[model samples]
Target: MSIFHGLSAFPLTPADAAGRVDTGALSRLVQRLVEARVGSVGLLGSTGTYAYLSRTERRRAVEAAAECTGGRTPLVVGVGALRTDAAQLLARDAEAAGADGLLLAPVSYTPLTEDEVFAHVAAVAGATGLPLCLYNNPATTHFTMTDALVARLAALPRVAAVKNPAPPSDEAARHAALRALVPADFAIGYSGDWRAGAALLAGGQAWYSVIGGLLPEPSLALTHAALAGETAQVAALEARFAPLWALFQEWSSLRVTHAAARILGLCDTALPLPIQPLPPSLHPRIEAALDALA
Candidate 1:
């Protein structure tokens, strides 16, 4: 199976207030994902603060996570950066650090044209032998990758999967449309945690999840149930996630997951600066939300 396939759990790159990675905390997070038997481990993704960290720090994050996974789990490291050369170098670093695959997003301050994104993705895909997943996170990347663009990029060598933003409804139509554009085996995954169950039921090949980053067991149960076409089982698990999912919509998944990780005692690190922590008043709600999943 492709590293990007199935339940690829992404973990927050635990870092102190100083923007320095706490590898010890990081290894523990990856260890939990490995022990849960998730299909793969996504390192340095948006949840992992890939946009905030420097190359050296990102490399350190991968080196540490690669060690924790230790070939037991496939490590798909996010190599998204502002510059094509920098992203290419990051891809190289991840491969050298033992990553099994790469996740590239069109990250630019000025909006990127399709031609620009195409060239950028092509360069990074060529940088290493590892397969790459196109990260279509318009909410963060500010560049929305269209289906035509996806089809164009899919033809590039080693571009094997796409982490798309799942639509809330009509997931089957959405999934079928994208499936028609890509290869039969090209992995078409979804990221929005609240919408993942429906996506899976509609044939989404993977769940590039945020909540699964901190809380994997329940997420895995949902993933397995949906993938197996167990409607009642998936609905039950999806209800358990309702409270937390609402929090995610309001506070954003990155901030909520940062809070969720701390609440669960998995990691106590702060998100990189300029992104403030969830106000203390939100703790009770977050607590109650987590309780639902419990």
Candidate 2:
């Protein structure tokens, strides 16, 4: 099976207040996810502060996670950078560090053309032998991979999958459309944890998850139920995590999730400067969500 399948934990980089990657804490977090049996471990993803970290920091983060994973869990490192060259360099570095796959987002200060996006991914694919998963996150990348573009990208060698946010509607039809356009081996996974169950039920192969990063046991149970088409179990698990999901809807999920992780002592909440921690006013609600889920 592709490393793209099932629950892939998207962890926050456990950075300290000094803006340094704490490899020890990061390894421990990876250990927790491994213990929960997540299908893969993703580092330097959106939740991992990829855009916020410097090149050196990003490289270190990948190396640290790769070292900790040590091939126990498949390591999918995010190599999304504004410049194609930078992204390619990260891709090469990730491959050197023993990453199982690469997740590339078309990040740009200005809008990008379809041809440009295609070339960027192709270039990265050429840079490394590892499989690549295109990240379609318009909210962060400002570049939405349309169905036409996705079909074109998926045809490229070494482009194995896409980590897309859930579709607006007719998700079943959307999944069917992609399936028709791409090869059977190509994987389609959704990242919006709120809609993951529905997307999986619609035929998406995986849930590239933030919630699973800090709390994988419950998330994996939820994914298993979704995959088995056990509607009642899926609904119950989604409902159980609904409070935390609501908080994610209100504020940035990165802040809320990091706060919750901190409360649970899963990792520190020291996000890189300017991102800010979850406000104190929201503490009780976070506490309540954690308590409810606990």
Candidate 3:
């Protein structure tokens, strides 16, 4: 089975003043990713504000990403929803919209049994012929998939990879356990913090990245360096990115990232309501961080 590899961007879903999806900005973002030579672009994931977007908005974002990407690289659309039926619908819509694969996360409303999670994955996998990448982000969602659960789900024919956002230490162990459970064909992707390059060096096949959406060139370069076993280059890049990572450790990490993107002229800092912009007081600090890295 063909598995996705290399740097995959978790792009932000650009929205208008009324909070509607902005295809024009989204198209520009996708074009930037292609220019930067990222391996793939992921739409409607956490960085894309998937939870804040409506079903219609999600579909539009996926279609726009596919249209903009124009097969320059693979596209993965996040198909996570609070309801299983809705997730399946989104998965089908994503496939119709030309997504190469779907990143599915467990339901968030209630904690699901292992059997329920298995059934959900099976249902989405069965709903569309597209490859599936399981998204495990326990920080936002209440439930976390156990190693055994991942092993069981890895047996499904449609399941191709796992996008793990657990902390670095846990991610290492999870990768080891999951690798033991599944065949070598099944890929393990990394997310969370500045540990992605390290994880990739540790045998992760892909890096699912939020930072890539903001600074695709640097992120892709770092990924290439890590994959090439150039530790010096990787360390140098990580050192430059340390300031940004420090900001992410703050309470308003997403807001800071979004705001920093706008400052860099990448996209607007406009986020969906309930996720207000970062405090004005921190603008200088964010600008300095961006400038140092730039």
Candidate 4:
């Protein structure tokens, strides 16, 4: 069975003020997440700011994470790039760096046909020996993986799981239908802090989480409750995370989460250019919100 089963923490890339990836800081961050005992660690994910970094930086980030984890935990590296060849190359690199699995999204410049999407994933799957997770994040990628395509990819060798962002409306039913459509063994994980509980409650088996990266213990508590079908406990955990989720709602989670990490003294709060840093005014609110998690 694949170890890609539970809460996979998506950590932020700790970069220096000049936007250079701080490998030492990143190593420590991965160690912290590993020590927190999250089910898996996702490096160079969306939260890791994969798109912002150069190829060499991304490679170093993956290597650092794998080196730090050192087989203690599953390291799922994101190999998402706009071009198929680049994605394939990253997949190969992640596999070589000892990553446990690959997470790929259909990132594109123009509108992509379903065939193009399928081909892109297929090429990456062929490139790596590691298991692959199809990241269906339409909001960011602007390319949606329809059910037909998902079923087809599920049949591909090395394609093991999917990270789906739960829809805002009819979440339970939507996830339930998705679950029924895919193969029985194919894992359908959910992200989107607001919809995680609903996705888990609706039979989704995994959560590719951003908040969980910073707060692993609490995130695991919520995941464990969902798996045991403990509805009340799940609700309670969601309520606990509401403050952080609310901050995510107001500003982007990328901003608030990095700010929260800074507040907790996790790392330097320097995000890459083009993506602005969290405003100073929201620091107190973010600090207070993070305090609530404690």
Candidate 5:
């Protein structure tokens, strides 16, 4: 089984004012996730600001996460880049660094045909022996994997799962189509918005969770309830997170999530340049929403 089969939190990499990684804070963040009993930690994914960091910074961030996690939970490193070689190199580095798996998205802004997407994933799979989870954030990558492509890729030995953002309105059809593409052993992880509990109850087995970054307890609770066939409890927990979910939809998700982390005492909310802090005007309302969850 892939190490990334259950609830996974995509943590934001904490950096200092000088742009250096705050390893101490990063360690604490990882420890908190471990304490929450998250199944995996997806390092340097979108929530981790992978695109904002230098390659060296990314490596150091992964290493720090691994060190802090200390084998308590699996660490799945993000390995998507505009260049295939770069993505492969990151995958290799992640493997060498002892990451349990890789979460890959297509090269940024350059939309590939379904065949090319498969080739990209195939190349990464070939480059590193690590298990792979395809990340399909169409909002960012502008590339959506067709059900036919997912079916073909599912047969590959290393392609273990796909992390798709929940599509609008017709989630049931989307879930059914994706489940039909992959075998019973393979999983479809939900990443976008607050549909994770519903998706999980509907047969989605994994989640690349941004909300979990701030509220690990509730997030894990929702996942556990869904897994245990407690759909009503899951719905109750999802209701508590509804306001934060609404905020995520209104603003830059990355910024708001990081800010929520800081408010929750999880991290410092320092992002690299070009990715500024959440607006001061929104802090009171955001904090109030998070406090309500508490």
Candidate 6:
């Protein structure tokens, strides 16, 4: 699906203190991305606190986002779970809820081997007709998907794309290495907001963006400039994003993004417990960062 090939904005899934998804808020957030004209709405991804939510709440989120998108934009719902059966059920749930595609991470409690992960991903891809994107988030998942492993998974039915961490250096070389391994049409994208612009300029087909969810126009600007190979414009736009990028690296994009959302009047819901909101002391810095973007 083309859903995996552009700016896939991952929005925060707002919920009440009781962990019940605030469907109204969730719908509003999804609609924002659609109005921004993003490639897709990436609902229930890590930024959405999918791991912290119960399956029921996740299903509710997909339902709300699907209703809001209403085919106006593509919806790529994250169906990552610790158990194979649960992931399969989530995939089925997303399809039933009107999602256009699925993003599956190698979510695990035990350290999984390459063979184990291959089987896990294959199972989920086989479970649904929707195109599946492999989520290679080693920092959170604790499983690094080697290039060879990605090549193996690409051949599986319904495996359409991948969202890897943005390269820290040599974006072209890194992107080229992976491109050589996968099929010509396989969509290759990156996350890690700070480094993503370079990845895009280096021929990354997509950006699985956290900031794009909160600040779409500028993100789209950067995406457009980079896609068009406008190096000078890309550098200028990326500079304004520098301060926020620094904060994202220091405080984590999850906390910083939730803070930005509140500041922008997007949502007032807190990050699900154990993952507290950013400290009050950091609010000034966040303000200054948002000011920089403005």
Tens-place lDDT per residue, model 3, 47-130, is: 888888888888888888998888878999999988889999999999999999999989577678889999999999999999
lDDT of each: 0.92, 0.89, 0.83, 0.86, 0.82, 0.92
lDDT of 2 by residue, 1-294 (tens): 789999999998987776678888888888899888899998889999888877787778888888778878999999999999999999988898789999999998988999999999999999999999999999999998998899999999999999989876788998998889998999999998888988988898899999889889888998899888888999999998899889998897889989988887878648888888987788899999877667
Query: How accurate locally is residue 135 in candidate 5, as Cα lDDT from 0 to 100?
Result: 86
Give the runs in model 5 whose Cα sits over 4 Å from its true position: 17-19
Measured with C-alpha atoms, the lDDT of residue 137 in candidate 4 is: 89
lDDT of 6 at 111: 97
Better TM-score candidate (1, 4): 1
Which segments of model 6 are wrong by more than 4 Å?
A: none
Tell me the TM-score of each prediction against the true structure. Answer: 0.98, 0.97, 0.95, 0.97, 0.94, 0.98
| Evaluation by lDDT, superior candidate among 3 and 4 | 4
Clashing residue pairs, candidate 3?
A: none
Residue 164 displacement in candidate 2 (angstroms): 0.9
Which model, 4 or 5, shows the larger TM-score? 4
The residue-level lDDT of candidate 3 at 221 comes to: 85
Could you give candidate 1's per-residue lDDT for residues 179-289 as a string of tens digits?
Answer: 999998789999999999999999988999998878889999999998899999999999999999999999999999888888889888888999888988899999999
lDDT string, candidate 5, 1-294, tens digits: 467677888888898766677777777888888889898998888888787777777788888888877788998999889888889999998888878889998856655788888888889988988889888887778898777888898899889888888665676787898787788888788887577777777767787798776567888888889767798998798888888888888886788888887777778747887778887789898998787688
- Model 6, 1-294: lDDT tens per residue? 477877889999999887989898888888888899998888989999999889899988998998889988999999999999999999999999899999999997899999999999999999989999999999999999998999999999889899999989999998999899999889999999999989999999899999998888898888888888899999999999999999999999999999989888889898889889998888889999999888
Question: lDDT of candidate 1 vs native?
Answer: 0.92
